[model samples]
Target: MFVAEAAGLDAIAATGTLRVPRTIAHGISGEQGYLVLEYLELGSRGKADLLGERLAALHRCTADQFGFAGDNFIGTTLQPNARTNDWVGFWRRHRLGFQLRLAARNGYGGRLQSLGEQLLGALPAFFAGYSPQPSLLHGDLWSGNHGFLADGTPAIFDPAAYYGDRECDLAMTELFGGFPESFYAAYRAIWPLDPGYATRRDLYNLYHILNHANLFSGGYTTQAEQMMQKLLIAHS
Candidate 1:
């Protein structure tokens, strides 16, 4: 857990990435995870815009290849990253296929599995012409995962850090509401999304929804199914 947290912090602090809290201490006590971090206090709007701009800059820091220097943790499970010059190949193997297989073992069968395969096949079309950089992403950038400093600068925490598409970070923001229009406006002002992103959003978000389904069964299964259905429609 400590190494995962450290990697997360490093990814966020790395050049072209968003700024986040440096973890002072983290450990498991009893049944709960404990962490000590630098505090930042700012409203959602200002912090949102700060995050937006910073994320754009991070995305701009691309590499000729996809994947990271090493593997990291998602929640508690180890996520391996084997380097590849192809973004589509990287996401298909390391992201979608890995998660889908995990979810299937955890009782995610049927349509979800079928849809995942279809999405994998369609990746090339979805991401055509848009080569992504190995941006240092917060990995997990939900509203609850971020905050502001006492001076009102954006401070993010609890990342599933990696070098991948910047949209993965942006898509997580929309998963649970805490961001404002200004944040998106600022992001676009810095780096615009590719034209086909609208079609790809559901596909990208499916990775998270599937992960959530594996982590917490309940409404997440329904949510994952809904997202899969939406992707299938687009594909059809």
Candidate 2:
């Protein structure tokens, strides 16, 4: 696990725009995996604009397909990265379908499952006019995962990195509240988001909510239902 995470950081830094902690070492000892990274003193706050611009720059790095070259983790959950050309197909099979199947195995069913099916069937409608290209993503860009270093350099870490719709990273930033308007503005200035991103943002976020429901409490299931309802209503 630690080796995978360290490799993810290395992958992000390879983009040449973002700053990530250098991976010093990684190995598994006994039942535990260990990774050694360069120690960084994070400042009290991050420069949101810089991070956003840098994030946009990172997203500019594109991929030929809608998954990573290899699989990685998202909050310790197994995230598969089998490659596919179709964007919607990739999300349906990998993101939404994968999570829903896991939830069913974990004994979450009924309305959540029903609504999830309906939403999954309508996934194509969500991207009726928008054709997304594969781009490098932090995979988990929540507020807690990024900040400025002691030297005031913008640094982002703890990534579940992959090649997918850049909007996935953008949507997760909104899930938590640490990013500033300047950050968003900077991102837009670099790569303007397509129209309908507002509603599709909920669709993108549902992946996380569903994952949360599987990983934690039933509250996330409720939230996922609400997100599904919103999408259905919008389509209707």
Model 2 backbone overlap count = 0
Give candidate 2 regions above 4 Å deviation.
Answer: none
The digit string of per-residue lDDT tens for model 1 on 5-41 reads 7767866676635667766788888998777876655
**Pairs clashing within candidate 1:** 40-148, 40-149, 41-148, 41-149, 41-150, 62-133
Give the alpha-carbon lDDT of every model.
Answer: 0.76, 0.87
Best by TM-score: 2
Which ten-residue region of model 2 has the weakest summed lDDT? 39-48
* Each candidate: RMSD: 2.8, 1.2
Model 1 weakest lDDT span, ten residues long? 39-48
How much is 63 displaced in model 2, in angstroms? 1.3
User: Which pairs of residues have clashing backbones in candidate 2?
Assistant: none
For candidate 2, what is the lDDT?
0.87
Q: Give model 1's TM-score versus the native structure.
A: 0.87
